[model samples]
Target: MEVIAIQKSTLEGMKNELKELLELTENATQKYAPIFKEEKWLDNQEVCLMMNITKRTLQTYKDKGLLPYSRLNRKNYYKLSDVQALLKAGQPYKSNEDGVIDQ
Candidate 1:
């Protein structure tokens, strides 16, 4: 049996490098995670892309009052928080007049 001896200083240096790498990995994961907790406004195009729905469906949702939105001029904006909340509700759309899901 042969033992390849590693020096103490080299071991200490490796340990420090490992620690720094771990910290960097953690920071990167936090910065680029799949889910974002912060609330922000989304435009119609952004909302469509995120929800995987068509633009017409988005308008239908707005008209049916399923998704809450804000209008300025001809453009509409929705809150990311509200959309996430509705998704989390997991309820069927109960529409007397095409009812939107409960949020």
Candidate 2:
């Protein structure tokens, strides 16, 4: 094997550059942390519990195009925003005075 050597100054410069890049990446992540937090995804059970419905009912919603979802690996996921929008719209179901969904 042949041996290759890098100058001490060059090695130091590379280290400094790598450190700066790490710092920049960290700052960017922190700055946009809240935005990522807002876009939460919920699974089938969670959505059903939140909406006070059953799996079949949730499937009906998907069938009727009232709710949107994403399917991955034979499992489904729903966006918190879309669910909130559906609740606000009160199309297929309505909530009574006690906040119970009325079908």
Candidate 3:
């Protein structure tokens, strides 16, 4: 392991930097927590597991506009509330005996 020394002058600067970093983190947490706390977004695997469906079936739902999602960085995210609403509303996607909807 390598050890580094900070002078007294640098110590105060480092403390100030740390404080600013923490403040920025706090501000971000305060701003973003509530926006996302209520509704969590699920990825493809999560959605499939939650709905007891396969990835292809999930894709079929997306294709048919039965499921809603937002794409970010080429990844799809589905809102928890939307998924719950779909389950509560009824079968969002039709499935055969194998539990996979025929596309």
Q: Which candidate achieves the best TM-score against the true structure?
A: 3
lDDT of candidate 3 vs native?
0.85
Provide TM-scores for the models.
0.48, 0.54, 0.64
Candidate 2, pairs of clashing residues = none
| lDDT of residue 5 for candidate 2 | 100
| TM-score of predicted structure 3 | 0.64
Q: Model 2: per-residue lDDT, tens digit, 1-103?
A: 9998999999999999999999999999999888658899899999988887767778778988999998869999899999999978875864455656557
Name the 10 consecutive residues with the lowest summed lDDT in model 3.
94-103
Residue-wise C-alpha lDDT for candidate 3, range 9-86, written one tens digit per residue: 999998999999999999999998896788899999998888877787888878889889998799999999888887
Compared with the true structure, what per-residue lDDT tens digits does model 1 show for residues 16-61? 9999999999998898564434557789999877765666667767
The list of candidate 2 runs beyond 4 A from truth reads 1-38, 91-103
- Runs off by more than 4 Å, candidate 1: 1-39, 91-103
What C-alpha root-mean-square deviation, in Å, does candidate 2 show against the real structure? Answer: 8.2
The lDDT per prediction is 0.74, 0.85, 0.85
